[model samples]
Target: MIIATGATGTLNGATVDHLLQRVPAARLGASVRDPARARHLADRGVRVRRGSYEDPVALRRSFADAEQVLLVSSSDIGADVVAQHRTAIDAAAAVGARRILYTSTCGAGFETPYPPLAIHAATEQHLAASGVAWTALRNGFYGDLGQLLGPWQETGTIAKPADGPFSWVDRRDAAEAAAAILAGDAAFDGPVDLVPSSPVTLADFAAAASELSGRHIERVVVDDEDWVAGEMANGTPEGAARFTLSMFQATRGGHFAHADPTLVQLLGREPRSIADQLADQNIG
Candidate 1:
């Protein structure tokens, strides 16, 4: 049996949906925190089990009788993310899971300015020592650039610290690649960077916005502190503002500039670019 945690979430849900097409529902299982939310999967014959990262025993029970398990990263912020991942990893190992797949970020590394990247790096280390074969799906930075440039959409001016390029990827593509790996069509051990073929800079985004919306969007470089203050003045929480600034700092440091072709190989086609994503959205 193959089990997927966070099966009700968008990413994992898409992965499970694709898996259902290739594998029988009887062989598929969803380990979600809320079984009631996943009744649709159960109605389709998938075994839905209750599991939460906070409870190791529940995780073990949810993973039982599964040959492969997909551990979708926990969404809890400010919590002990590393400990939560360790708990899930331990439970997966204890349940005799032959292999485990973890959803990680492409920017996950020691030098990343984002705190969650450290947690992901640490979780990867724990997975390495967990004895079960594992694959770290290093998903690229999400293609939700519009959310980050929220103020710019209104002001028609994008202001931020000097930034580098990012190979933003659509979550749908990431989920499909993950499903291929889970379905045994593609084999990957250790970290696999799933990113687009090219990196996109903030200037590139502004240009895309201009073209897609029929309006000129200017890109301006500002001091990091000024940007953080602006975010806070706009009613963003202090902690969230600081984290957003750190992400820009990390971007300026070229932490997210790399591009990997693994996603293309897995999908058997070129993945969508930031421009394509922006064109689809009404960012105007």
Candidate 2:
């Protein structure tokens, strides 16, 4: 069975769809924080299990009858993810899972600026030592820039921390690649950089935004400290601001810019472009 965490989220939903199309419903397991949130998955014939990354007992129960498990990194801020992931991994190991797949940030190889990237890197180290066959989807930035919560892009400028290049991947594409890996039909057993084919700078992205939305969008380059403070001022929790700032700082450091060719090779098609993704999100 393929047990998928974060089944309520965008990436997990797409991953579950791909898995269900290839594997049978009985072979699919979905671990969601809320069973009610997974009604669609149940309707589509996936075995829905209510669980969270924080609860070890729930995780253990969720993986009881699983051959493979996918840990979509929790959306929690700060050290919570590390603890939550540890709980899940320990549970999976105890439940005798054959293999585990972790969704981590791209370039989490000790050089990424995102502090959580360090958490993922450390998790990878622990997974490696756990003696379980594992794979890391080093995912880059999400392509749904226009679908952010709160204000629409038209209300204000698209704010990103960096003026550097970015290789944004469609969440659907990442999920597809992940589905392929989980199927275990090939000899894949290491870190796979699930990035886009082309790396676009912040300026290029702003241009795309303007062209797509028919609005004159601008990119605001803010220092990490200033950005954190601004987020706090804008009613974000202090911890949330710090965490968001860390990711932006990482982007400025080129942590999300590297475009690995293997993504297209594995998908056997050109991954969707940022314009294509933005359009799909109904921005263009």
Candidate 3:
């Protein structure tokens, strides 16, 4: 049986749905935070079990009678991600899962500049030490959703602190990749970066978006001092704005620019380009 965590989340839900088509409903289980909320999945014939990152018991119970478990990372901020992942990993191992697939962040090596990535990198290291067959999908940024500068995108101006480019992957593609890995078609024993074949700078992205939307979008770069000032002037909370700006600054340093060939090979075709993805969404 294939047991999947984070079944309620967008990407995870999509992954489970794809796998459900390939595997029978009896062979599929979803670990959700609330069984009541998973009525939709249950209606589709998935076995639903209650679980959460904060509750290891729930996870242990959820992973029971499962062969393969996909451990989707938690989205909690300010908490110890490593600790949360450890809880899920321990539970999966206890249930004797034959293999584990973890959704992780891209650029998981020690030299990565992004500090948030450290949590995932550490979790991957721990998973390796757990003596289980493991595969890690070190994912890139999601391209379907716009950033916090979303409102700015509508106004034909993107004000960000980043100075460089980012190569983002469509969440749909990431979900499909997860399904393929869970199907046991791709054989690997370690972590792999899930990113596109190419990247586009933030400026280029904004410009292309403007062209697609028939707007004259322009990049308004903000420095450290001005970033806070602009945030306040724009009615943003000081603390939240500072954190968001810092993430952009990291991106400017090529934090999200990692490129890999694995995505194309796994999908057996070229991953969607920025323009192609936007066009599909009718954003252009």
Candidate 4:
């Protein structure tokens, strides 16, 4: 059986949804923290078991008799992410899983102003050192960039600290690609980058917004402290405003610019573009 952890989350939940289409439900299992929340999946014959990274016994039970385990990266901010991943990896290996798949980020191994990259780097190192085989799905920046991009549609100006390009790829594509791999039991060892066909900078986004809105949107460079002040003045939490500033610094330092055709090759199609998402969200 193929076990997918974090089945209730958007990325992993979508993977389970797609897996139902490609493989027998009986052959799949969902390792969720709350089985009650996954009633829909349980009704569809997918095994929903309660599992928590903090509880290794529960995790082992959820992963029992599994050929592969899709270990979703823990989203517990302000927690020891590496230790949590280590617990899951140890459990999967102890349960005799042939392979362990982890959802990682492209920021791994890059020195960045952002703090999360360190966690990813440490988790990947642990995965590599584990005796069992492992694969890391190095996903691109999947979260909403509204915080980084700001409300350029309304202001017509993209203002921030120096920023660099990002190879954007939709999380949906990443999920489906992962599902395809798991269903076929494809051999993908080590970290595989899942990025878009091209990179996009804030300037590129401004141009796209202009085209979609029929107006000229300008990309403006502002001092880092001034940008933070502006964001805080606009009611952005002080902590969030500062972290967003660090992200801009990381981008400017070329942290998230990794690109590869692996994602396209996996989906056998072009990943969705920024314009497509902006249109779908009705972002004017």
Q: Which candidate is the best by lDDT?
A: 1
Give the backbone clash total of model 1. 0
Against the reference, the lDDT scores of all candidates come to 0.88, 0.79, 0.81, 0.87
lDDT of 3: 0.81
> Please, what are the lDDT tens digits per residue for candidate 2 over residues 1-284?
89999988999889999988888898999998899999988998889888888788988888888889899887775456777887888888899998888998776867765677788898888778767888888887784464332243745466656556667788888899888888758856767788878787766766777898888877667677776687789788998777666665676787777778878977899998877876787865
| lDDT of candidate model 4 versus the reference | 0.87
Deviation from native of the Cα of residue 100 in model 2, angstroms: 0.5
The 10-residue segment of model 2 with minimum total lDDT is: 143-152
Residues 1-284, model 4: lDDT tens digits: 99999998999999999999999999999999889999999999999999999999999999999999999999997778889999999999999999999999887774777877777888889989888888899888877868657788778898877788877777799999899888874699998888887778889878888888889999999998888888789888989878877777777778888789888888999988888877777877
63-124, model 3: which lDDT tens digit per residue?
Answer: 99988899998888777878999989889999999888899877665564456677778889
Global Cα RMSD, each model? 1.4, 2.9, 2.2, 1.5
Q: In model 4, where do residues sit more than 4 Å from their true spots? A: none
Give the lDDT of residue 11 in candidate 2.
Answer: 94
| Ranking of models by lDDT | 1, 4, 3, 2
TM, every model: 0.96, 0.86, 0.91, 0.95
lDDT of candidate model 2 versus the reference: 0.79
Residue 261 in candidate 2, Cα distance off native in Å: 1.9
Report the C-alpha displacement of residue 200, candidate 2, in angstroms.
1.9
Question: lDDT tens string, model 1, 187-263?
Answer: 68899899898888889988988887789999998887887788789998888888877877887788888888889
